[model samples]
Target: MYRESLKKSLYDKEAVIDVHTHVGMSPRFFRQYGYPYALSVEDLVIRMDMLGIDYAVTFPFVDSAFYVNNTGSSKIETTTEYCNFPFELENRNMLNEVNEIFPEHAHKILPFLMFDPSRETEKQADFMEEISEKYPVFGIKTASTYIQAFVNDVEGKGRPILEFARRKNLPIIFHSSVHPEDPWASATDIVDLAERNPDVRICIAHSARFLEPVLQKADGLKNCFVDFSAFIIHCKLAVQNSPGIAIEDFRFRADYSDPLSVMVKLAQTYPDTMLWGSDTPFNYWIQKYYTGDGKLVEDRLECGYREETEILHALPEALKAKVAYKNNLRFLFGQDI
Candidate 1:
């Protein structure tokens, strides 16, 4: 048998599913939304095949105005979130492109609606709820980090989406920036919403960069999950964020307080609430661009799905299976297979 086939057999036949990834995105453009990258199913499958990634949750990019609002205020310095960014209907249609690609592949590809509202307009959320009916999405992607940082709500920003998740049994993966006070999307903000909306399954992407902020509190919340897709890059960022420190000073440590070690422990801490993801080209590409290296895409665009996945080798087999795919299947499909 092939390597992946042997691994599948070893695991009692559970498929490896990546919970977060974008097929394509327009990093920059003059006309608002830029062009999506090469996100054809073939392109995705090629990468997934290399990593033995069986299924992926794919979505499109939504142009966002994150740091400041339309009202000339800094959300970072403000306590109350102000929904002042302007979004257009035209920008939300990347779902259509994703739908066009994944449907043919059957279980191999799954599509999620990326609905990030720019302002406190119930209409945008309402509009996506109406438009979502026209598409086939297994779940939804809400924003806190990579997208808009609007406060979670029921009428403005992601308000309309709450209804969709409530009605459709849809699991929502949030773009999180929870710890140390991310005005855009924080764990406190997400947990508050998750607590209120008990019916919806919420997965905090990257588990707030795999720190204790999100995981430390998930034991009490049955529907809250944590995904660690971009662990290495986040580790790299931790180093870069502390440039003046020596190389040896750049360590998450190898103890219980260490982020990676915490990931392993959380398997036993909140086993049912942990999952794995590969933010894919989106995470890799955006990091390159934001770090002022997008022009060197060839070097930086190297995929890290494997780096993210192999790190889980430290987990027990059962826990690895749970995070790799079982938890995702249970959360998204309500099936253990």
Candidate 2:
């Protein structure tokens, strides 16, 4: 058996799934959206394969403006940013490329198309509907950075996007965590959406780091999902936000409150409300701690995509199975994986 197959036999019987990730970067948004240093899809996939992640979601890092709206007028504004610092690609192209390269696992590699309403909301929505119909997509990627901060739609920026996906019965993934200085949607925004539209499935990316109280409060939202991506494993931005907390603090509870432990606690408490995700390539923790040699020795056993399956492997088989895949399976597929 291959490494992943063997690992599956040993610990996980169900196919592993990572619901959060960004496979490709736009050269167009490098300056604005990408980190000074970032990983590529080739690098990310190899790492995940080594770590035993069967499949991952490829989220595209797009400029917020373009993601919200893609109209002719918006295109003109977006073109100005393309001189050198901007990099963008069509969703169809990215999906087709991946499908061609990995046909068998292509369906496992879900792509949530990006959109910007200020420019091409209708066009992007149309494209999203087409992609969902043609290819199996978990949902659409919506950034609070553009809709909330730039557009100043504190109330409705993501509403339309979520509504658009709702019609297709797809989910909307939101970047709920706070960046260094950028202000975007908060947990409250997600809460409002969930309360307003119970039918829309929303995944809060990065578990809305440092906002556990807020997220816990929003647990009543039925279609809400949380992607435990890049929160616990030594993310520089997260460290910057909460200074004086060393990475070592996360491995042991006696030292301090580890974010990963907190996330695991949330998962254990509300198993059906969240899914495991690596947030590949762009997010440092997914590639380093989970895949590469880092502080999360336990996470290393997971290969790359940190999930409850790997976390509860040593427990009784029945409970282990529930944590491993059953909970997330219910949320993702509405039944099982």
Candidate 3:
């Protein structure tokens, strides 16, 4: 029944499934900044309803109490000013709470759990295995940068986590960056891991902030996929057109990437691996985009993801639909529809 019902949302329909949305507040928010606003699961449901989004693959905030942002990375300075990095409110049980309210809503919200594998590698794996079986977890996320892991390798620091994923049929979404000193996981590291575990599905999160090294590594690995979740062409255009849009959110450091040009090339060359994901509520903000003359216009996360059709003028309807919906369902879920 669920699979059949899902067809109504897809089957070449222009349905969108945002795979990178977080709900609820993280721990340590009050300590870093007083009176912080969080994007609750309820807020996400309303946004999806208003935008006609078909489904959102959601996750819990990282329980980052053990980790702090003293890395002095440029990305850290910008985001940490407004954000406290996800704190220690994350675990498998937290995700279960979100699904308790899933069925009452119109849109389908698939939830995933976040973990830091470095604490007790073996225990973390066991906990993941248990909850994955007990709950309806679609996948697992490794915010390596947030978790402070070196890479996505089984032999390296994340061995226990990677070993668990290698055996299980579950997919892993790894936070990747191309920077030499990413302070998180690197794209090169993910590529190496994917080569060793060909059967395991891996998503190189955020396109490694548009690092070509990842794409080069993904060339031979069929199970590897690239995500345009947090940053996309439309997001860049929105900032460029609006004078004071930076005031809305500089959390995402799309400093060098031309997401529009890069997206077009990736969609054409690696169409199969390309997937759409909204780093929601993070990206889903009420940003006032002003014209050249400073005339304000109402544009928000509701309109940003549709830039391929509305703004970029490069992606045809068929290709646009593929990037937005088909690519993800087919590749990730192994479903043709």
**Model 2: per-residue lDDT, tens digit, 2-39?**
32343233234575566777755543335333242344
Q: Candidate 1 vs candidate 3: which has greater lDDT? A: 3
Per-residue lDDT of candidate 3, residues 278-332 (tens digit) = 6765453343322323343444433353442332235576666777777777654
The lDDT values for all models are: 0.57, 0.50, 0.58
* Candidates 2 and 3 compared by TM-score, better number: 3
Tens-digit per-residue lDDT, 1-337, candidate 1: 2323423442466778788877544433223232234355567777788877887787655443322222222222211232232233223444554445444553466667665544444555565566556655577776544343454643354566677677778888777663332356665567667777777888877655544544556547878787775655655555455221112332223342244665676577667877877777544543211211112121232335466666665567788888887787777865556
Stretches of model 1 off by over 4 angstroms after superposition: 1-13, 29-38, 62-95, 98-103, 117-121, 154-157, 178-181, 238-263, 283-305, 312-315, 334-337
**RMSD to true structure for each model, in Å:** 8.1, 9.2, 8.9
- Between candidates 2 and 3, the one scoring higher on lDDT is 3
In angstroms, the error of model 3 at 299 is 22
TM-score of each candidate structure, all chains considered together: 0.71, 0.68, 0.71
Task: List the pairs of residues colliding in candidate 3.
Answer: 63-87, 63-88, 64-87, 64-88, 145-184
